[model samples]
Target: MSTTKTYRIILSGGGTGGHIYPAIAIANELKQRFPDAKFLFVGAKDRMEMDKVPQAGYEIEGLWISGIQRELTLKNLSFPFKLISSLFNARKIINRFKPDVVIGTGGFASGPLLQVATSKGIPSLIQEQNSYPGITNKLLSKKANKICVAYDGLERFFPENKIIKTGNPVRQGLLDIDTKRTQAQTFFELDKDKKTLFVLGGSLGARRINELIEKELDFIIGHNMQIIWQCGKLYFDQYKIYNNTKHVQVHAFVNNMDYAYAASDIVISRAGASSVSELCIVGKPVIFIPSPNVAEDHQTKNAMAIVNEKAALLIHESDLEVDFENNFGQLMASAEKQNELSQNIKKLALVNATKQIADEVEKLLKK
Candidate 1:
């Protein structure tokens, strides 16, 4: 009798769409390569992944996990307890699943799961989506078999030998959006005569971006510009009133992101890793406003990577109040500048990220 084992793989990452979507994208690529492979996902209990994973047609297990708050909060006190519980839980899942390979995209759940998988001598990899590695990825780097990174110079945070620059995995639909513009404008009900600006602040939303747009609504319209604003779930109630306004559509979430990217002439977004990658692929003239709330101020670093390449323009959140109008106006009036930014950012697009990362996983299985 011929015998070939069906490969089993474990993927853990969540807490935000930035982490969750990349994990899902990687899993999708892996499924395509190993048609009969058994895939399992581990995410923090109560996180969006618990709901998102099942929707993606993958079975998932949740760890009782969350991150330690930077401030002195009561949640920080329970962090140690949560860590211990998650490690134990991860071990149980590892033992039961006996995965041939384990992968962590980056989140609290990934921390315990990868740590346990590495300790058990299973092959494991981590996908770091930022220019600066997060605390979880940095700590887990010592034992990781491979570290797939989105940016260069992560050797400062991870082992030089394990690091591979695979870039960030973005939705494949964005790879060819030039043909979608007319269809996208029709989809969003946007006037083609007016310039369209896409405002994205991650899945949870950005308070400063929403506020700046709210204050500058008249300014935007006066310049013959329309906006498709993704206000995020948290701020939807506060900003949804603008949905009734002319030339403005405020959404809690943008489900049709491919269409949205196609419809945009300019993009004003937070510098989250996934957003940056998608924007690069969409090849739009972009203005980045990095969130100050992230650990190590990494969003700024992520934005700078592109900005330094002259691929995009950045406005620190603190500078928005003073520079929003002049900077936005100058970009709006200058077609030459817009084309330069679009072409430059497109040059940085890494369309094969998902495939490359999947290839890395396949290598581990062979080893």
Candidate 2:
């Protein structure tokens, strides 16, 4: 009788929840397929992933690594030292772990780890979750055996032969949100008769988005609309004062994300890759206020991808002060417009993204 072989895998990515969660989702799907696979995660030390990965039931190792801030600072001076240390640490991990496959989602830790893995001739894949690739992923693309992307035309950055347009992995549960609307309304104690607006700005929160909600609370309430506002963890207290009011509810984080999506007739969101993917699946009319602070201005690029398709509206952070009320009010007043955006965005949803990414890994494993 043949004994089953244990496949070893090395997955590296982190920093924000955007990178961490997709790496976790891909790992989860791979685990389902290779039940006996041994997995190890490499993330930047002190990053949220160190805690989040273990919470997701995986063992992880940390590299002494971080990104170089665009603006000059002391951290920029330390980047070379950090990169050297990370590369050395990465070599040690690869030699010790001896992974059959190395996978990188976009993050600072991924660069050194995947670079070291390729030097050793190990099979490697990268998952780029935006229309525009990040500096790390763009640099690593040359050696990657497969580049799984969430948008088309990234061949401008990656080798066309290596590109695979696999959409970002969103929470699988979000696919069934329509079935949860009634339960979500009940859970939030919202009136069944009022239209609900879901506002999301990602986990740490967005100052501009929080401020917009604060300024428009009365306007929304007066228009007979209810709100499920996820102001993010940072600004929760600052904005929590508006909660439980007649038509407003403020949350630091919405743990039951599917319910939040289900309860909404429309959404106001930041266009992070994971949020964009999930919002596509949620199929709600959305106004995307992309954060300007990200690398490569990728958030704006992400939102534009959808807007180009006429699937959603794009409001820059700079323009939100002038455009927020008018853009939102237009969507609110027109059911026909809302339906158009909803249907068009849903057409871009790749509900099987995790599985497709897993399939790419499976192919690499077979080689």
Candidate 3:
């Protein structure tokens, strides 16, 4: 028998935790399976990944690139230059690392890294976390050795033959939240019996969703419902003192997300691809407030994919003012509706996506 070969893999993604965390989860699995494997990450320079990757105990290189500024600014003129620099840098990194395979999660840097990796005859894979594919993933797919997707109907974006609906790989830790529902109540000092609503605005938080909750905090309480609100870091300090009573609570971030998800009867969140993927597993009756700020309005497209299937409800940013509280009230009153959504969205859950992604990575190494 031949000896097993050690694999060196390069992982690329950044600009958001939605992309970074899944990359980490996939890397974590590879570490467990191939303890001898080497891994490197590439992310946009001066972005969150510079801090996050080191924190995750991985070595990452930075590309001097950014998204094209939607509003015309002097920085927008640097797009072509940045693209050229990133291409040169990606080639340098790939040649030095000599990885057997490359994996791209959605981010500003993934475009160049994966494109070069594919050109070099290395097997490249992309994990598209959204229901509607992002433009980077769409372009990368033409050369991707395999495309793993979370949502169906993605054939419109990638070659159908290369696509695998593996869902988003959620950290196993989140799924194993300490089964302490009452403990979560105590953790947040919440009323154990009152209906709990968890408001999430993606990994960072949604300003519009947070504003809506702030506007309707009293009405939410007056209706005899309790809340565990994650106001995101930006608005955290402004609202952290919102502990008017046991029925309402505010947090900058929920360290124990599994607890927050477990303690809640309802969730109000942005429709980020990862949020939608994890929510499908959490099985909460969710109100998706899709942000219009993202590229391609991907957040709304993600939410609509589920809403159109009747697996969830959508509240557009423009409609939040008029529809949020009223629709939320109706959802809270109807356990049947909540249960139906909960069951239906769970149907889309692929809990084994992490292992599956890793398995595919391992298979490529042998070939």
lDDT-better candidate, 1 vs 2: 1
Give the residue spans of candidate 3 off by over 4 A: 177-180, 241-248
Number of the top TM-score candidate: 1
Alpha-carbon runs more than 4 Å astray in model 2: none
**Segments of candidate 1 deviating more than 4 angstroms:** none
Cα error of candidate 2 at position 126, Å? 0.2
Candidate RMSDs in Å, in order, are 1.2, 1.7, 2.3
Best by lDDT: 1
lDDT string for model 3 (1-367, tens) is 8987788999998887789889999999999998888999999998888988888889999999898878989998989999999999999999999999999998889999999999988999899888777777888898888888887788998999998888898867667553767777787777766888898887677788888888898888877788888887788888777866557778777767778887888888888888888888888888998889877798888888788778899988998788887898888789899999999988877789989988888778878
Reference-based lDDT, each prediction: 0.92, 0.90, 0.85
lDDT, candidate 2, residue 322? 86
lDDT of the structure predicted as candidate 2:
0.90
* lDDT score, candidate 1, position 43: 98
As a TM-score, model 2 comes out at 0.95
Please give the lDDT score at residue 52 for candidate 1.
80
- Cα lDDT of model 2 by residue, 47-83, tens digit: 8889889988999999999888878898898889999
Order the numbered candidates by lDDT, best leading: 1, 2, 3
lDDT of 3 at 260: 87
